[model samples]
Target: MTLLEWPASPGFPEPLWYWVEDWHRLLLWATDQAVSDVTLQANQPVVVERHGRLFPVTRRRLAPAEVYHLTQVIYGDNAPSQLAGGQDIDCSYEIPRGRADLARYRVNMTAVRAGRERGVEITVRTIATTPPPLATLDLPPALRAGLVFEQGLVLITGPTGSGKTTLLAAIIRHLLEDPHAHRKILTYEAPIEYVYDFVPRVHASIAQHEIGVHLPSFAAGVRNSLRRKPMVILVGEARDAETITAVVDAAMTGHLVYTTSHTNSVPETLRRLVSAFPADGRDGRLADLLEALQTIVTQRLVRTTDGRRAAVREYLRFTPDLKDAILAQPPARVVAATRHLVREHGRPLTADLDALREAGRIDEREYRLFRGLGTQADAISLPLPAGPDAPEPGEADGPG
Candidate 1:
């Protein structure tokens, strides 16, 4: 069914078409339908993903020229020319909802092989207008306690689409909503996802900076936040060596820091961060990182039996004893030592998955898939039946 066949809602107009002229309306309709992502590819019908499945929204395929024009409209006039330079573009887009309201999206334009010619595909992930409350997240007691630190580093590690941003946002929202806690928070995100203007803050305040728009990179943003006198700093992701060093420095100088990394488990997260430094000074950097570390929580989203998804997490709060235990191990045994210590004093991801399966929150296939993986809990979600215009079998990519 097309957009017109869908019932009219409060702010949505009724006579919307499936063509590019009404692209914003189509996105709004997809949002209303609880779509998580929207894809626009050359010579393909507009597609939307919901509940880990993809389906087409438009009946007719979009021409190459139409997609090119659409790309220009979403980005700037130089978008197509920029894509021709063998580089993908990532930026944010929004539809004006009211005088001061907006529905923002994280958009990416990638160059793909369309027959012998180069084609463009635009993928858009919807951002929630406001972050959910931390109480709704049902985090473990240990994790909740670790968030009360005054000066240390807290990392939420996971792959893309694993709710890392959502988890950080909830924690930030909780800190801001606390009446007794008075502080300043600075955040640096690649493209700001969740806007917090509607959140009612008691005494805490926040300022956000985009990576490219406000600052050149994550490292620069971390360095910039130090001069702003914020009690807490949030770095979007600690990917490179420079950014990791900056995060460690901020934590060292008596400022609470929070960041995300694209790692699967707690031990791997530590290993990855320590390995980012040069080999000559790697041991020193590892000591600094372990000393300033407060907690590392790795999260993954698994498909549930009810067509939704649930977050399974592994977390560790690094006490002095645990830190010493890790440091005492040689380089070859560091990962093994960390794993043993985590199981002894922290929550392993396998236990959480087992609990979910026992409670019937997740099915047996999903549990076995996650349980069989190694330290890196990278497992593909079980494929579901697609919609009317869904892609052919084996064409669907799993969750990002």
Candidate 2:
């Protein structure tokens, strides 16, 4: 099939192109706009997300035929067959910019019913070709140090678009750069994001696999990694009971396993993982999980005062005492115990927000928003500054 070429000057004032037929040019334009995501749907204007805000890239709405053609370009000839199976598909899309540069996106294609007609909605998330350095991620020194474990499970948890994958990539980069340890790192992802071949890896070698493309599932990938004799295993997500069990088993057998979860806090992450198992085996599974856990890092991104986003993290490193306490108590008490530890040892999310506020790194309104501190004075341990000039803690927009 021949791909359509976009006009040199395309936008308002020009004829409306109901079909954005040039995928490469559209993607290139999105890349130049620093778009984090692009959404294309039949009968809807093409939209792009930048800095957590969505805006239309073009005023013209796309047609169903255009969406189908784009999907074919993205997924090749097999797209029609795959879509006929009545399930969403995830894949990676790339546009070559120059001899050395490429723009990559993680694409999700789903079927949508427009009355009696079946249409498609495509959402593409931009990914950096190279992972950022660990130091640049603003992680605490102690937490960074604790991530370099030989045998244990380290989980990075956060909501979607919270930069969990970016943080994990940085951690993997750190491990690859270590001079003393010659390690074999194996990673399993739905669609592989970062490419480490360009980096100078003298001591470590990395092998990345895609979940549906290279392996059947995350659980199968984890089980397969064991036979490959890898020192570090990276599971994109411990999303289901089977995958979680596989990760635990891999850690138990003396491999360092890293994974992500869609949870907001340490205790909540633990609870979610334990809830994956049946009630009869939850306690025992929770105990085993606690024993294998090395760290739980929960991250959030807030708008900085300078008009950029900065990471605010709440992490808990498992010490022997804390692990023992977690094992002894029921899962119901874990949240309270975790809160006590956050007050005493770990840095709580509220404290991080407060510090940012005190340093003037973020505005008072944003501070209160991210901290979830309401008007009730006693609701929060650290009270907002009290004065006539100060804005009321409750007088702010919704949380970011």
Candidate 3:
């Protein structure tokens, strides 16, 4: 069926036909709709994700040939050859709008099985042209203070799609905007999502390199960043032993290093970092890590009462006493100690959730959801504010 002739569908504008044939126009339209991600699969309707909700952008299913052509258009002729080896490929795509303005996307191309035949699924994530300022992100003041450390390792930890990368970019932007910030910052990103050249650099200079494209690996990039004499280094992630070791060593050598991990809590992040090393010297490595860790910010996006999402974070600033406590205690008990210290001194995730609930920013259901309390009747037993506006148990809760 023709795009115009198709029946009306949800989450898409009525004039969708104008851009179906042109992939670039289609992407531009999606971006205008505030779509964070777009998915195109053979024999399936185009899907778009906005505000953590997914919906079909069109009523018509895409043909196999259309998917193939779209992939080639986004990734060039070698797109098919790159996918021929049956492994997923990650890359970046951009469409230049003007001399310096462009719309960038992080793309992942993978092969899918479609009823005995092979098909392709391409996922595109839209990247903001400029990083959002810290003031606009609704971060707590305590967390804000952690971003200005002169030397040590700072980690932004969260699950996938939890805005970890965005938070890191904002911190980098914060440093670059400071009048007295004369530090040189170097970042190693896998696909290089955000660009900082648009921001006027008063005292800080930034150089961003992509993994597998500019350098071999995150470890190699960190080792190379030292030679460039940068005061601050942003490693995209510390997933392996080599990369984690490099980041810790960089922090020890007096370079303020920033990185991310896939853990959901501050204690879990510390455990994951140390666990990356072999068991033979895990304790020593953990001690070294504790000595160099300056801050840990673990965050998750929770649904707000206004049909949007807000960041709920648990963070800790490692003081000398906290570091000593961590090093002196057994590894298993550190998580509990860290939790207690953060609750008493820093902002904990539960405290943030409680504040959000009391301020009428989120409902009872959302608070319970992020807190991991089961949906039993007793789980949401907290007394909600008395009013006609009080939300029922699970009613009116949007996607987190």
Question: What are the Cα lDDT values of the candidates?
Answer: 0.81, 0.78, 0.79
Model 1 spans with C-alpha error above 4 angstroms: 1-21, 374-400
Which TM-score value belongs to model 3? 0.87
Itemize residue pairs with steric clashes in candidate 2: none
- Residue pairs with colliding backbones in model 1 are none
Top-scoring candidate (lDDT): 1
Off by over 4 Å in 3: 1-21, 373-400
Local accuracy of candidate 1 as per-residue lDDT tens digits, 289-391: 9989999998988878777788888988999999998888666556656767777788888878988998998888899889853242232354643553343
lDDT by residue for model 2 over 151-183, one digit each (tens)? 999999889888999999988998888787789
293: Cα error in model 3, Å: 0.5
The best candidate by TM-score is 1
For residues 80-187, write the lDDT of model 3, one tens digit per residue.
767767767788888888898998899998877655556789999998889998789987777788877889999998887789989999999989998999999999
lDDT of 1 at 209: 91
Instruction: State in Å the error of residue 68, model 2.
Output: 1.8
Query: What ranges in model 2 sit over 4 Å off?
Result: 1-21, 373-400
Please give each candidate's TM-score. Answer: 0.88, 0.86, 0.87
Best of the two (1, 2) by lDDT: 1
